[model samples]
Target: MYGVDACPNTEEPPDLPALGTLLVDTSRNNRVGEFRGGAGCYWSLRPMGGGTEWEVEPRHVRLALPIEQLRARTARANARSRGDIL
Candidate 1:
C-alpha cells in the first residue's frame, strides 16, 4: 500500500496522495489493502466473537527496520526502487 506521499523524505508533501484506510480480515494477515479519506488505515483485531476496530495513525506509520534487520530491508527497498517490485 505504498503511495506518493507515503515516502515523505523523497517526495514533496504536496505530492502525497489522499490518505486512505486499510482494512484487514483476521484470517489472512498476509494480504493488505487501502482506502482514501478519513481513517487512512484500519484493521479488525480478534474477530472471533467480536471484532475490535483499529486505525493506523498517519503520523506513526513508517518503513522502519530494527538494527538487526536493517541491512536486509534496506537492500530490499533499494532493489524495489530500481523497479516496481515493491
Candidate 2:
C-alpha cells in the first residue's frame, strides 16, 4: 500500500468550484445561485436571474453544474421576456 486508503470503499471530498461561477447552496434547500465574489472569510451570492445579494460561508455553497446554469439562465430569460424582472 502506497499511503492510499487501501480500503477502496470511501469517496474523496469534491474540490471547491471556481469564483464568479454558478453553485447550489446545500444549506438552503439546494437553492441555486451565482458565486459573485468573496467577502473576507465569506462569499457573496445572488439569485441566478438577479436579486438582492446574500453572503454565505464557504462551507454552505458548492459549484453549480452546467445543466443547472443553463436552466437558471433560461428561467431568467423567460422572466425578462414576460417583464417579470426589470
lDDT of 2 at 26: 83
- Candidate 1 has what TM-score? 0.21
User: Which parts of model 1 have CA positions greater than 4 angstroms off?
Assistant: 1-19, 36-80
Candidate 1 per-residue lDDT over residues 1-86, each given as its tens digit: 67844543443222223333232323343222232333223322222112243433343333222441344345546666766333
Clashes of 2: 1
- On a 0 to 100 scale, what is the lDDT of residue 2 in model 1? 71
State the TM-score for model 2: 0.68
lDDT of 2 at 60: 71
lDDT of every predicted structure (CA atoms): 0.34, 0.71
Taking every candidate in turn, the Cα RMSD to the unseen true structure, in Å, is: 14.8, 9.6
Instruction: Tell me the spans in candidate 2 whose CA falls farther than 4 Å from its real position.
Output: 1-19
Report the lDDT tens digits of candidate 2 across residue range 1-86: 42442423244434445666788888888878877777555567888677887877677777777888899888778878877752
Model number with the top TM-score:
2
